[model samples]
Target: MQLAQQRRAFIMETVRRDGAVRVAELVERLAVSDMTVRRDLDALAARGLVEKVYGGAVAAPGTRVEEPGFDAKTALAGPAKAAIAETAAALVEPGSVVAVSAGTTACAVAARLLDVPRLTVLTNSLPVAELVRSASRDRGEAAVPTLLLTGGAPTPSAALVGPLAELVISSLHVDLLILGAHGVSEEAGLTTPNLAEAQTNRTLIGAARRVAVVADHTKWGTVALSGFAPLDRIDCFVTDAGMPASGREVLADTVGELLVAGAE
Candidate 1:
């Protein structure tokens, strides 16, 4: 493996296993200079995989300790989310029914769906459904895919919850389920912070013929409060170019297909 790639893998694996690791230890273990280790940590930190501290780094909190408000997450991973959303949006063909989960990444995908013709979008995100409707109206196009918003209580993240959403998800099967996760791991699989959200994800996964998870590089390694799908359940993973080498390895070894978008 390339030295830079190896350094990233070493640091990620260390954090995944240890839950937290220091820069000095990473430098010693990877047999790289302190400067190199710090650079690796900086890269990982940029993706939100690890939290950088004085002389060390810690695993990002797995649980939904603080779900960023809708506006915050929308502006947080701007370029990466756009790349991922663009790639995912292309996968939807005309007249296809797609189930979109609730997350900032999924919200971005909804925004790009503005131009897709004749799309029936099923979603548990209030923000996404609203966006789809607004786009359809603004374009003066045929009411594209009929928008189906899963009925449920709204979470702080703008996710629709309660048994009503589950009922809506369980009743129908779709061509694709575009999902987002708090963490993706070979061991823990797809995970999320809220148990209700995880249950909702299960319903979405079960109802779709194909599952495509849209997550950025930051979601790697951190395990959330609940497990949603095993790695094998995901047919395709759409992530940005900045994903770590170790994360790519885990995804390749675990998921069926890995599409690294925004990479040269």
Candidate 2:
């Protein structure tokens, strides 16, 4: 096996560039055994150079600890979020009340709601509320469900979050909560950089009969400033095909259901 420091350096750089590195990939790249690569990854994780996940290591949280603007985030994982949103939108039944949390993925979910007959969408996301409203009008869907927005302060991510938003969300129960998070991991569950957003999400989750989280693979293994929900609280998780093989196994056993869109 290569010297520990050298192996770790290569692994760290790979994670930095690719965002993540699978154990098997590392093993091959380093001409090392699986155990050797895992040991190097563990050492890197201990140094905060990487974040360990089920079968791989990801670049440690950096600026991700500070939430990015909505437009910035929408560009990072567009295809994965789009696929996840498609899977999550399938969960909404016609005429059901759905509460969508603020995030790019949740907005994607809202974009698909125009076709669902009589879908009442209550949201803390300014973008989601507006998207559903203007899209409904644009499509001229006569049976569009009622739309509700929480009254609160706006965050950089275009989320209305604070006491006012919580009060409004807490008072109303919805058939489902379509959620988006800054990060998600088995260790952290669901997390966000903003504390107000965390509290608002918790309130929304409490008001829902079922909760579905839509996030891309990039969100995995990342824990931000505040965690709002545990894996057990999620009724279903919809992600893209890019999720690591290790994550699929863990989520299958942990969540009520796991859906990977665009997977063969």
Candidate 3:
């Protein structure tokens, strides 16, 4: 293989095994100059294959090993998230109730849902709830469906946690649930890094008649700590065109429909 390709492969492999890696280690492992390692790290960061951090590089947050901070995730796939959110928003008919999970992608979907009319949104994400409220106020529409915030302990990423969140989720029935995942695999299904969050997601899924998973391309084929739901439970999946063919095929085999937004 070419030097660049070999370097990238080595970096990814190291991060996968060690959960995180530093630039110095990469330079030593590849026998490449520090400048060469930095360039490789930059390229990987641009592709969302790895994250560039202070003094080193780390595995991308959504991968099984590293739980990415909210800011990092929000920046990873801005355009793809916008497209997925827009497509998902279009699926909601007027006056329908939708349940959204707590994730950056789901937050984007909430932002898009702001344009829709007379809808009720139920969510376990503080940020999503705030977005919905802001949108409702901006439109000056009082008739919009109530925005319910599941009250609970806050996770590092502002995810509502604890039993209260699950109780709130179980209390409502919704027409659609737009969810996000830490990782998705053909065998392990949809997974989340936190058990409390997974339990909350399960409650939301159980209460919805239809489930739509909103995720960017990079989330595919990874594994996390807790499995939220099996692939068969999902009614639809909305993702960007950049999703890998193998992952698409796996999703197609598992879910009822796979909608590729922004695809040529």
User: Order of all candidates by lDDT, from best down to worst?
Assistant: 2, 3, 1
Candidates sorted on TM-score, descending:
2, 3, 1
Ranking 1 against 3 by lDDT, winner: 3
Model 3: residue 200 alpha-carbon error in angstroms: 0.6
Residue-level lDDT tens digits of model 2 in 176-246: 99999898877768888777889899999999999998989988877665679999889999999999998
Number of backbone-clashing residue pairs for each candidate, in the order shown: 2, 0, 0
Which candidate has the top score in lDDT? 2
- Deviation from native of the Cα of residue 19 in model 1, angstroms: 14
Candidate No. with top TM-score: 2
188-250 in candidate 3: lDDT tens per residue? 689876767888888999899999999888888776655789998999999999899998898
TM-score of decoy 1: 0.74
Q: Stretches of candidate 1 above 4 Å error? A: 1-64, 141-143
TM-score of each: 0.74, 0.76, 0.75
Q: List, residue by residue over 23-56, the lDDT tens digit for candidate 1.
A: 7787677777888888888876765567899989
Error of 3 at 120 (Å): 0.6
Pairs of colliding residues, candidate 3: none
